[model samples]
Target chain A: MKFRMNPVYKKELKISVRTVRMAMIILGYNAVLALIGLLSFYFTFNYSFNNNIDYSGILQIYLILAVIEFGLVLFVVPAFTASAISGEREKQTLEILLTTKLKPSQIIFGKLLSSISSTLLLVFSSLPILAIVFSIGGIRLFDLIQLMLFCVTTAIFVGSIGIFFSTCFKKTVPSTVFTYGSIILLVIGTLAIIAVSYMIGVRNYDNLYSASSTMIEYNPPGVGHAINLLLINPAVSLLALLSKQFGSPSYLSSLLSHYGKTNTVIFDHWYAISILIQMLLAVVLLCISVRTLDPLKNKK
Target chain B: MLEIQGLYKHYGKFTALNGLNLELKKGELFGFVGPNGAGKTTTMKIVSGLLNADAGDVFVDGINIRKDKKKLKEKIGYMPDFFGVYDNLKVVEYMEFYASIYGIEGKPAKKLIYELLELVNLSECAGNYVDGLSRGMKQRLCLARCLIHDPELLILDEPASGLDPRARFEMKEILRNLNHKGKTIIISSHILPELSQMCSTIGIIQKGTMVLKGTVEEIMQQMNVSNPLLIQVVEGQDKVISLLKRNPFVENIAIKGSNYSIGFKGNKVEEANLLHSLIENDIRISSFFRQEGTLESLFIQITKEEEGEKIEV
Candidate 1:
């Protein structure tokens, strides 16, 4: 089969590449990452040298860099993708595009791919700064590759959320606000729900214990199935990935175990499962965006 | 090459198109004219597949639009009334983008882009940024973009709405040349006189329906039936008035000096016969003809009559 670049993606790439804004973005992105990496390296070395400790503190720099990059992805991906469709509408070019032979799915995917490409550009350009840990002995090549893969998966997931809201709204501002709002809901709202459920479970267990006659075997309350809700949260996935890389998978498991005793396999593979779940949700959101982008879908 | 049957569209309680019907043959330069909110844009959008009619059948080249929209889209190129150009994109690149959408790319796409640019007389501005161009240039570039696919039918809504006279003239000439090249074009504009001059057939829509449709001369004649006839007599003005009053086709007559303006409800043959009768009676006539009706007048009369009917209702 012959391969053809989607026209929207091609045009967006052409235009974006020609603009100085892309250059500035890459420069600024790298500058910030390098600054943060240097600061973490300096502080870790200062603390270690004063105590006459080994250079194992370089690993902390890697963790700090990885976490900051993850935060950047979560914060920046939406700004790129949230205005993809609504910008076209605001510029009044969407109708002309609709009249063409391009399908709605093709357009949606084109916008998504373009936004993801921009994000990936930012990610890959800062690799040098991220690779500063390689000079030391802690982070391996496979781990770096895994981190990049995780970043990409998170980008696609958040980018899909941005595109979904873009298709739902006609203006860029509202689409962006709603996209950030949804991210906040996923990051914080899920945690809040689990917290509330855990508290309720604890209260119920206390009532049961107090109302029991004679003596009873003490069992702590857990959030039970509600802990599974965090599977859609990227932040938790990042923490799981970091904990595993830091050679302490128990940190994440213990943190999650406070809420509930989950299947050991799930905790053992939390990163993979969370990544899979987020990717599945991204697909669903992209499907909905494709449907929403269709001009004739609402016609009776 | 195009047919719309019982096309109905509504926006909440307001009906944009109410059973609107229209058809066009191959190589027709059809002019669509309507007041604001008359569903001109709605019909054009529906035909372009950018919009869906509430209920109707739109066929292009025997392909039902609802059943086979992709095929319909393949055969139609639509330029909306209001469109914007992408910043940082050159005119040639813009054309290339649209051309690629139709699956024309590489060498063939480049060649088509230049050809369309030349057609729209923007060949020299190919490398210039689209946003830097003037409004008329942007509009012409849009027209060029739509033609990149070489679609059989072009739906252009108000292509010359905001253009100056020189630009309007250039646009009309481009459309005329496109029509000459066997491309069926449906263009809507408020410039009625230009439409009358360029369109092989004109359709006037009002209140979600096509109130008038025909060739320029046919429409003028249709509306001129109610137009008065002016007759200037060199001699025997009273005799001319008396003869006009007795004629069944003449509803009323008004005299100002030697000229008589009569409300004449007669076809061309009857009008000729009336003139012949006056000449046969030895009433020396300097000139006798039906008042020359303009498309603007006919449009106003039709829309006004509809408005009056609505008021009465």
Candidate 2:
């Protein structure tokens, strides 16, 4: 696809990429990725390579690397965007920028694009380390492509959350805090609520009938309820995607397997559905941020 | 040219602007002088399209600011009272960034950036980081940034605030040059003397309303102090006072430290006649001349009149 450049995006990229701090961040990010990959390799070789060079261990290494990349995306993307708008306000530059001819959507899109681009640089920099699985026999190139796409989508989604809060709050500290808080709510809090709902549904079903009755329970209410919850839960969907990749439930999704099988239609399609949900979230958040920024527009 | 009519704004019940009406003609250097919290910044923001007005219409070259906000952005260059710069950007790069925002690119943008740097007297420091510049230099750089797009109208809110005397003088000179170039400038400041020197017209606002607006001479005439004649006499002070009071051209006698100052309404001939009368009376006159009404005095008189009008109401 052809790229239509935004001036704000171009300028922000120039400023960020030219900084010594960005150089150091890229160096540090690669160093951490290299160190983790080496350690995982050492452990996998010491245990499995002594007798049999098992391909299963290589797949385990790929999963470890993917999880590490995902964790890094969660921690790094917000740092770029949480202070995107609030920092401009703090530096006393937002007013001058607002007076320019650019629309509010261009401003927000530029911030998000710059942030996502920075994180993508880090993600792509570690591709060689993730490429170690190619020497082994388990992971395919298509799997790696899917993994990278997932990382990019995750960064866009998380970065939008940061930009949204940055516009809502006046100070950078609160905006950053609330951005991380939102990630936690999406990842952990959603699962906790779904679990509680599943238990409550099962308890209500049992209460509706006597325990000794020989009645066959068809597709229990709790299992269907949990499946719906997992369908929308980003963390769960991510785990489900990984489970489908390795032909077994990953650690997180394993805990929720009693509610539903990974091969079910919705579970099998979790990756596409999760990406759709994240894209929708990014658009909604960016709209709110743009509306909050332009004073000439209606407040409500 | 710009016109604002029936402008009203309130922040949580505290009125910032109340039915404010103001107009500026093309090629006019209008000084917007007011006390703190008198809505100077608010009015400028509204004109610049940076803030929304509750009930108002700001027209620039016959285009409504609300309807064509983007068109207003192209016509007006706004320099806020307080601002900042990106530390990572060089002076030249900063200008280029803004030029690109206006859709000027490549060679044209580079030429404009160099021209702007020269205009602001920062040609030697084009490669220097923006955050490394001194406050005066930064102010000039911001002014250069505002002119990158060659906007017709410049709205500067307290451009000289927090500057040293030398820096303030330099800023005043720059503004004078810009005004001489036929740019319509609306500058707000508390420095009355500076405004008097640089601005052709002055508007004084109080409590979110304009108290008076006109040329210096017109405002002086409105204040009834068009020609205040001051005379000093060492001897026959009572005779001098009596003589001035009896003359048809002299009125409002005020005395201080062996000097008599009175309001005189007449042409050069009448002024010379009054002086001759003082001399013929043998009042031992020490000095005599008409007092040029100052901006400070006009401000004080307008505020006092407003106070009186409020009390009467």
Candidate 3:
């Protein structure tokens, strides 16, 4: 059989593209990245020229732009997707769509794809600004591709979260609010858990040492398995990726060493592992949203 | 083209449908009638694959809903009582979107959309934004959207609930034309007269069950039995009254001056025989005919009886 575009995705894209909102979004998004990129480049070049320092510091501008773009993805993806399903309900169009031949999975996947596409549009439109770093010969094509892939995966992850909440709530306001809330938990909440566990481990080590009469071999307590929770945190994944690309593989390791021993293969491939974990989580969320969208599933 | 047997649906302690059995043949314009809170909409939703019945089976075009839902949806087109249109989408684009949902696209979709737009008298407004259209136009567009896939069964819930007389007339005409084209349709409405005129079969649902189902004429005949027979006599009023009292089908009689209203429960032949007997008794009859009963009256009577309340009719 020939391939066909998902009807919901096609329709959403058609409607979204026709609105001035999309143009404004693209314009505003690119303007911010360009403004920040130009300023950072000017300052870095000016500072290096004045102090007679190495021009290699200009590469920091690429890292700064990637971070800002990643932050935008986290912030804007949920807003794009949180209203997807709930807006249909609010407009009273869901019932009609539910009656069509389209499956619940198709509807959910289409909504998620449309949201990711919109976010990707913003990301791709900013590539020119990001390419300014390429002129300095510091960032490679592979690095840019990796960053783009990371942004796409992160958008899918956050967009799935928004779509899941959209199916759960009837109104877009609560869905958007809960999506951001969940993102915050994934970002800051994982770090907080690691901090709390490390503190407990250190406290136990201190009590054990204080009770000893003589000096014993030092075995500093570590956070143990709690470090694995960061696999689902996109911020940690970005930090790992950037740290490696910034020519300091030891930076992420030293950062992880503060909480625990970091000699595992998972830590070595933390970026890939985190992205995989987040994609898996996105699939699970998308499945749940599909189930929730199925009106017949509510049967007694 | 549609059959539902022993379908039951409940919302907590409230039962929306309880053992409701209904059937519609090919090309039937079935008018599903009931008072508020009846199972009309629920049954429509269940048949349209929008809701699952707790118990019983619904078969459309001989295909069971539970066994193959996708096939069932392909055979059904459902228009809800209330709907909304996308703001930025043109009428043609909206139709095309729904068409694509059924896997029809490109040239075929465009051709079907224009034809459907013409069918709904919306050909001129095809380029207009859907949200800019009036409510009647939107309803028409929705109806057109439902037909894009050419489903055999069309389930419309209150398709003309909030329309002006002209729009209602236009909708009725469109539905009539569709029915004449041999499409099986199940429609529910508060407008009984229109349903009576447009529908070939009528089903009156009460509570969760079908209290009555038959042709429009059959139901009208059934309700007409309870209608009062008016007798206007210029002479021998006492004799006419005595003769009516002696009849077995005469339930009650009310007199107003020269006009006598007799609640006669009888068929056409029985009614005619009684009129003949009265004429044979040397009664001067100026006029003698049964009062015409409306579908609204039958609906009220059936619903009232189900509620165990006394009905004045």
Candidate 4:
């Protein structure tokens, strides 16, 4: 094989190699949580619902504990990427690397991809725990695929935010703090938007709900519609999915068939719009980083 | 060859360089001397392309730096005033990184890296992390990295700043050897003595401009100091300055107890004639020679009374 001459990427990859050992610790935590998720679902396998232990309560207990695992994934993925650039500036190594013949795009991409590799590892480690949920019944293969898609899109969105903030600040402490703060706000912001929209819709159209009867639509505000929550916020999406499966009494058995149909448009809207917005923002933000890394040209 | 014509740089209202013109041929070491903020560093940065010049052209091997920076960059090596080493990178890797930047690789690259390590005298420390090396070693390694592309011109900014006497000597020797090999070198140094040893000519800058530019001897001629007469006698050598001060041409005289050096007021002939008269008084004048002007003395003489005004480099 012919040896290629590439200094900037070679050095970046070497530096990434040393720091990526720090990645194992991130994956290790996910592994531990996934094992716990597996055991919890296993113990709920043959449980009775004759007394007060209904199927809805059984799934609720497991879902709450499982949401915590996804939360850890979201929190650490940004943290891994937040310091990638600022750390180089702190050590005084970035300038020398910039002097090389390597283009600025190569440098920024190498850093972004390095962090993504670690994020991918943590995302995949949760698979074993998720498989146990399959045995609980009513889980679709399409839903599982949609959940993984949601994890990747959201991580990419958060990872790009982390990379951008890291370059925006000089010191690592301030950069990392703002990145974490932004991640928390992003999560809350999504939930808040849905809640506000639902309240307004209910008040405007009284037909949507009534005093003596229930509307056919079961709209859960602050969460995605059944399909959207499945694809975008898979945890909440899955909760809405499981809610339909185990609820209701013997007297009204036939009402359960129509649960998944309500508010399906929310997924249709967010899926296309979120992917487009996230991708456009990621490309634009990284272009700024390329300019940031240009030593002589960018500063003036 | 490196040629700079009509170079000018401004930071806000402050102009660092104005209409600066210089030419450096291969095998010549040009010393850049200046007081604080004299634009010596600014000019070097422009030539090296670390900082852009507001006006003018820098051509390395006849390729315009502005028009074709990558091509020009291939022929010029720049060592900034301050630099750093990466963590977990060894000396060999550091050299390899730069070598690869120049697009050299495989057996040829490994061979070049080995030779460069030896050239910088860091061969033994090839496996050691760069941060483990001393400041002087790092500076040498930086120079070595600059040479990885076999650049024709070298722009070194304060190459020996903050080094001990021994380390400074080592740096000086390394630079001298590179200059001896027909490399065009532009060196900015605060230590005038270092420049004195190796520089063929110098430009002294004061307050963002080059005030004095010439050979060492030419700058000495501009000084109003009297011609120095070195009186080596068979007998009483110390009495030369004392006896000469009373004469017409002498100013600021220093007596060496038994031997002395007096600043002569006029031309070489005038001082020699004065000494001739002293010999008639049986003072026994055997040998007399004019005191040579060192770069350090000339640097002080030009910049001292200028009152820190901005000058063009």
Candidate 5:
């Protein structure tokens, strides 16, 4: 009951507000994305009111945007958070803090949460733009909800990874470089694997003559299946949201069918399982970070 | 109260502390003086639970450091040589951060932080960002941070190493104040004069071994036992020296400047008799003081023996 709300979280939150660059980055990014979305809306409405000439296509556009946003978060969160612990070490302050009554778990969790919150602020800042996109209709609340949830979960997981690396390296630069490096490897490596798997799977020798006419559709290499593949990597937890929301039969063509998943409860979303997995992995990594940072072991 | 028994620490094959033993009573301020590579910081680190000893037990207020280490940490406060700070954070917020670590918050936390800042004389700088503060301010704030938990023992490793003259005086005053409040403090430094002024007892460790430890006066007595001492007087220097030469307690005497350089003998009662004889000789003694041994002098004397002899560790 006496758990300390991480001072790291509070300090980070304060710093996030005070720093000019944080505001510029978060606000400026959302504004640019919003400007693009609004300009597209103007062009579409000006051309035709074909009843469906609304934000129906907006989800796909923003889904791509979501991936970009989450990708940026994945790369940036670690750079910011990975140095949290090691920064303390470099400043030579970690020793004094360790002497406090604070538990190691509390300190690590606090640092992780602080980093996640800063990254989450960027995700949350895009809410008004998202709301504008929804003004044209066809965008369900569940879509936005899933988007928010995935963004938070992915940031938490990535932030945990960052903090874990921070604990491993005593200096800030190496921890930061290593954290960003790992994220790049995770994101790109998974994408490369999925692409390769889809390429090989689609290359059936029996359909060689048909392969010339074979068009990858309904389940494009870059769409639903690719989205599903991203669920395993915490860096792309946000992609699972698009898969859950936009991969529906209503959103996609009825050409591809999968049981028990094409139609999911609107409220009791199945993607929660993937979200939980990502959250669990983050928590576990954070626990390991806490353990590694325990100063008594270092002294020995 | 603090006790470290058989503390042994090694970095690879290089031993830092070899069978080091130390004790301090409640409300006692002990100065730990040693040359570089003398294991003073290593000993302080282990005792503070910032480091673990290879083979030893550290107890603070009768509580073992290893058993429920966090609880022991609550009883001990440590201020390393260089303290750190957070970005864009006020002095009050910095204190609150550590206060929260100790599970103190809200009104209780604010009250404590306010009091600590006031104690460190940084109360006016409560709203100022830590980065904007001066080095001396940071040092004082660090001291305040350590005392946030109202800890029983403070383990300071070279707290005054980089401080300027005024800042060092401020730090000494703070330590003296804390010691006056009956707090037990173990401070490690290489400065002999500051330790003599501040600490009631002193421990001199050389190359992982504590060469000497006791009350400041007691240590000086032990270190300079039977060593030559000069008793300076204003006038009648020859009469005092000749009179003192006749006494068996006086080994011999040499007149230096206007004072008598008396080679002191072993017995305290004999010294008292010699002093009485000087008074009877109408020697208007300007100053009659024994040459007090210093930590610096002893450290140089002891460590120099093994210096440059190709020490394996």
Candidate 6:
């Protein structure tokens, strides 16, 4: 079959990208990235740095810049995607769209693609500055590629979540708030659960050692499961990637390695696993979003 | 041709369509007249494939909508009552967008878009932003968008709902032209006189069911109400009144100046016999003609009957 782009995606992109608002957003985004890069350079120069050009310092700047860019993407992607369907409904264009021959899945995917593509533009624009880390010898080209992939995957994941909420709610404000609320719950809730479980493990070990009254060492049961839980947390995955890149043991990796030799497949390769989890979440949310959009499928 | 059989739809606890059945033949201008919340829009949505009936089937050109919506959608063009336009798209681009939605693109899509815009009398505003167009112009643009695919059946839901008199007239002219071109149209409107003037057939729905249907003459006959015949006499008004009263077919004779307005319930032969009796009585009649039953009266009569039935139930 001959392939065709979703008409909605084409039209939305044509209208959105041609707007003054999108131009201002791009200008504002690049300015912020440049400011962050300059600030990182100034801080690196003034703080403890070698007399020669320090590659590790540059790597730190790269990581900080990447995090800031990711933060901006997370903030902006939901605002766009969360309003995709609800905005159509509010503007009264959804009924016309529904009467067309386009399938629900095509509509959902088109909305998602347009939302993430804008964020990807921002991510790709910051790549030249990110390439400065390549010359520093610590961060390789493959690391930058992996980081860009992670950024894109994260955008798709978050964009799909916003679309899912957009399909569920009637108004854009509520859908947007719910999308952000879900991200917050995923990030903080996962970390909070891990912290509570760790405390419980430490307390239980203390109790067990006291009852035995012998110098017996204790390792928490199901530490691998706990590490698997952290795999879904993007912050933890970023931390693990940064530590691996700099060849320095950060707190995230130290925590994982502190536990005994359990199968830490996810923890050892946390970056890849985090991306896979994000992809899985994106697929699930997109499926649900398409289903919600299809009235017939919704009933049956 | 389109056929909707035993269509039923429910929104939560309320029933929107209950065993509703309707059919439209080729080249027909089918006017769907109904009051608010009478399931006109619900049925339109189902036929457009934007909604699914709870228990029924919609067939366009003998292809079941449920079995092959993708193929069926190509044969139907739907214009909603309140559709929105894109913010920055030009009128021509707006047409092109919907044309592309129906799988027509590139140069052929461009040519088709221009033809549709010309059909809707929007050729002058083709280059202007869609958002900049007036409400009537925007409505016309939406109509143009609907015809971009050249579908055989056009389903227009309240196409002239918020239009001014001039705009309504223009829209009517456009629809009349489209109907003249042999396209089947299903139009829902509360403006019964407009429908009476244009539609070849009409179906009035009330309480989620078809209360009255068929051609205007057929519905007038089905209503079973007496036709009001007005007779004017140059000099024998009293004689005419006496003669009309004596006639068995005439009732409720009322006087307006030198004219007599009486309720005549009989067919053409009986009306001719009554007229012959009036002439033989030496009543010099200046004029005598029967008023045709209007769609407005028929709609009111049918809905009143529906209300009576509901109260009895």
- TM-scores for every predicted model: 0.95, 0.91, 0.96, 0.76, 0.82, 0.92
Looking only at chain A, give the TM-score of model 6 against the true structure: 0.88
lDDT of 1 by residue, B99-202 (tens): 88888989998888888899999999999988789989989998998888789999999999899999999999999999999999999999999999999999
Best by DockQ: 3
Worst 10 residues of 6 chain A by lDDT: A258-267
The local distance difference test score of model 6 is 0.82
All candidates in order of DockQ, best leading: 3, 1, 2, 6, 5, 4
Which runs in model 6 stand beyond 4 Å of their true positions?
A: A1-3, A43-54, A200-224, A257-262, B220-225, B233-246, B255-259, B307-313
Report the lDDT tens digits of candidate 5 across residue range B70-153. 678878889888867764688888888888777788999999898888888999999998999988898899899999989999
The residue-level lDDT of candidate 2 at B38 comes to 84
Supply candidate 5's per-residue lDDT for B135: 88
Off by over 4 Å in 2: A1-4, A202-223, A249-257, A260-265, B220-228, B234-238, B247-258, B263-273, B279-284, B304-313
lDDT of 2 by residue, A1-300 (tens): 644479789999998788789789889988887787778777777877458756577787788788888888888899889999998899888889889888888888888899888888888888888998887767778888888988888888899999999999889999999999988888887777767777887787777655546777544464553455555456665686687778775554556566544456555566787788788978898898999999788441
The i-RMS of every model, in angstroms, reads 1.3, 1.8, 1.3, 2.5, 1.6, 1.8
Best by lDDT, which number? 3
Q: Give me the overall lDDT of model 1.
A: 0.88
Docking class of 3: medium
Candidate 6: pairs in clash: none
Give native contacts recovered, as a fraction, per prediction: 0.83, 0.72, 0.83, 0.43, 0.87, 0.66
Top TM-score prediction, candidate number = 3
Over B174-229, each residue of candidate 4 has an lDDT whose tens digit, in order, gives: 88889887788899998987787778877877765566776655556654344466
State the lDDT of candidate 6 residue by residue for A130-151, as single tens digits: 8866655678888888788878
Docking class of 4: acceptable
Q: What RMSD value applies to candidate 5? A: 6.3
